[model samples]
Target: MKIACVLLLLLNLQQVRTDLQYDSCGYWTYSKGFGLPEFTERIVLNDVTVYYHDSSLRSKMPCPDWINTTAGKEEWSSIHAWSVHSRYVSALGFQSATKQFNLTGSLSDQNIYQASGCCSLYPDGTYRAFVTHAFNGKDFLSLDFKRKTFVAAVPQAVLYKTLRERDSATIEEIVAYYRTRCLDRLNILKQAPGVLIRKVPEVRIIEQQKVGSITVTCHVTGFYPPVVQMVWLGPDLQPVDEGVTDVLPNEDGTYQTRKSVIVPEEDVGEHTYSCVVLHSSVPDNITRVWGGGKAGGMAVWISLVCIWLLAAGIGLVVWWYRTRDAVI
Candidate 1:
């Protein structure tokens, strides 16, 4: 459960930089009807989580020596206290916001609030960053660096923008954090005693013979960074039409996904079909070909596989947990 909280936190991070080092942090709270809200705080460096605190656990999640996180008790306590205060304030905010929008929902409907910030640093020593917030899974407000002010993502958020914009000091503080603290953390992570480990994607292919066609499935797993590209290649080495599944998170924070295509029975021996994967972890694209000698030698069965980065709504993560349909 503790580990799940960390993985679920990944849902808050909408997009990840494939070739940049980043320091991103977010505090998320989930509530439903009258139940006490559950809160989680997370710090991610280069898309890998280094620090995590779950309100239910009441402690920072543990990490191995390779992922060294040196946060102290004072930091955890302060974040926890802040989360508690946030839960209270967010509850009131949600009520008023819902009323203002004339939105109606069932009592069982869930509510979520999150404040997330991220800074991405390039090799050339330049950085881009922002601090943003969402309420009930909609973008409420975001920091505009150029104007040094808050902007509303929707009409419903104009009230928040007006309120925060009036507080120039708060805006300055957010910009300072983005420019200094966030980027500093990225630098520290880049120079940490233990460098970020890159786990290459393990690729394999399985074929299932049906009545008039054969289905070839390329299973890629055990990869880090959670960003991967997989495509089906025809015998001519051209991209082929295929069905790809969502990237699923492994317990160890790695990811797995599959791309499958069907081969006509008559064209089975024509040539070969391949699954080519591109990811940051690998120096070159990994290709797994199906057909030829392997076609003759058969395997009876093949075993299977973050489901996040869900922009627009982080509430999907809350729903997955609220109902145990699927739990990583």
Candidate 2:
């Protein structure tokens, strides 16, 4: 019997763990360049596109000093142009932004080359960098800069196979090279002048009267970098298994999320519930409580007393009017 009870308890704990939802987000960084008549440069973090520059828009707006120089223009016009054409032919249909270059210039050659790189910072304090070079829209080569190995995105063409066999020594030397060349550049571009830090989320709790019970909702809003966790806690400070809504993006680049629980009618006034929020910007978890806590209970009682006093005064006035009419 004791063993059965222990197994049952463990099963219950596992269920509880599965019932409460959790969130884990990481940092993503990518650098892309487009070429020719429509030169473009961009950097993205997570899924949000942060920095973008279009050669088309350069004439209308002042160009940033870093990529606006004569040598910069030439490099973008030639090399980045080759990258965009490679993407156009490879046609991988990546969800990331696509660039189309005018076919007028030196791009008449069927051969094209591209170089794109991405770095990711995981929550566990580890980082990884990946780089890919494509030929005429087909993957030609890829490297896991951190692992110092070549990844087969697609089968190596005869030329690549022959070159790899001959230059294996050189490839080995530069396998770890992108740590500075690409990863550091990605970080530097993210911190360029106009980057905005994600704001701390604001949390509030409100009670709603349902048919036979009360539903308490914790509303969180006005935060950037859009990942957050909010949970409703019962009297024991354990998370309640009630439903939580998905985080919705607001118009102003902030995000809003809500989680709710239906409290028993009897627990409304007797027990206090709490909403705990976890976000990256906040060092400590934020807690908001309802049901007769210091702040919430005081306000509720004051409002109730004011309503009672108003009702009593109205009743007294009505009584006085009736008595005056009887005397007349």
Candidate 3:
């Protein structure tokens, strides 16, 4: 089983998708694997990538109480050292996760890293620093700072242990490797896809009736970069805030999404509703209109079906009359 796992890991290493994301919060680094040939069966994109943010500084932005004093400003300037140490805290939390790791069969696994931290100057000219790794995303391991421990995962602990035993690694050494080597590599890997790939989405407005309730849905599909927005507009041109689904992955690596609003039965009228989709690639918002006596209402479908039946009936009547006359 162990040999098989190693082989699979090596096989998956042919392509890498290293995500180096840095927002207003802080910097993060992680590596992921995408298998070759059948690129659809990606591993790293599916795995949980770990990132830690120094919310301590962000929480006190635009001159917090800590920065009021010169001493506090000095501590803040040296935050890089603090940030590196915080990463170790986050890794410790990764090692402490309790989730079971599958060894033999399918390699789909979930990994969590805790990411939160704090550094403050004490009254005796001493610094009391503690880093906690926790985030708001689902399955992110949380650290109880007061207790100074993390909830460990079995797979994470095993990996950490193996690395530690291999090199007699200390916390400081491991943290340095992550900051200097891992993150730098990630920065390079992130730049591999130089040009931003953008695809304008195909948007359409549709109406669905179920249990007497009509849902006006805007179906948006076949887009790249996945960043998109859909908004429903009333006939008055005001924006209607409806729920939109997250951009989901398509087989071709494009994205698809949907947004919907429930229209009151009485309010259904010709040209009463429209959906507008916005994406970076689109020069203008794609507008799809429904209702207001348009082609996408339940009434319109019923009318079309009736019209087809009426035409069929007329043709049958004409044929029968001709045949009867000939027989007489």
* TM-score winner: 1
lDDT of 1 by residue, 1-328 (tens): 6334423333332222233444456555545543643665666665655566655675555434443445433443444455554555455556545655766666326666666777766322446676777777778777788689777777877775665567688577657766776655565555434334557889998888899999888999998767777776565444576554699988877889988899888877765676666665644356666774444322211100012222224444444443553111
lDDT of each: 0.59, 0.50, 0.44
Q: What's the TM-score of every candidate structure?
A: 0.65, 0.51, 0.37
lDDT of 1 at 83: 53
Comparison by lDDT, 1 against 3, better one: 1
Q: What is the C-alpha lDDT profile of model 2 across 1-328, one tens digit per residue?
A: 5434423322332222111111211111122233433234444555454444443553322334555456444533443443343334234322111222233345432334444656644322344555565545767556654455556555434334344435566555445433443344344434334334557788998778888898888999987556676666565344576765798988777789999889877776766676766665554356677774433575444433433343345435544544454310
Error in Å for residue 189 of model 1:
6.1
Candidate 2 lDDT (Cα, 0 to 1): 0.50
Cα lDDT of candidate 1 equals 0.59
Residue 98's lDDT in candidate 3 = 31
Clashes of 1: 1
lDDT of 3 by residue, 1-328 (tens): 5434322332232111111122112323221122211101110111122222333334322223423556444534444454554455445434443323333233323334434332222112222233233322334433233333334333345444443334433445534433343333333223222223466788887778867568888899997656666666564434566654787988877889998888877676643565656554544346666773543566444433433343345435544544454310
Question: By TM-score, highest first, what's the ranking?
Answer: 1, 2, 3
Q: In candidate 3, which residue ranges exceed 4 Å CA deviation? A: 1-112, 115-196, 209-213, 292-328
Q: What total of clashing residue pairs does each candidate reach?
A: 1, 2, 19
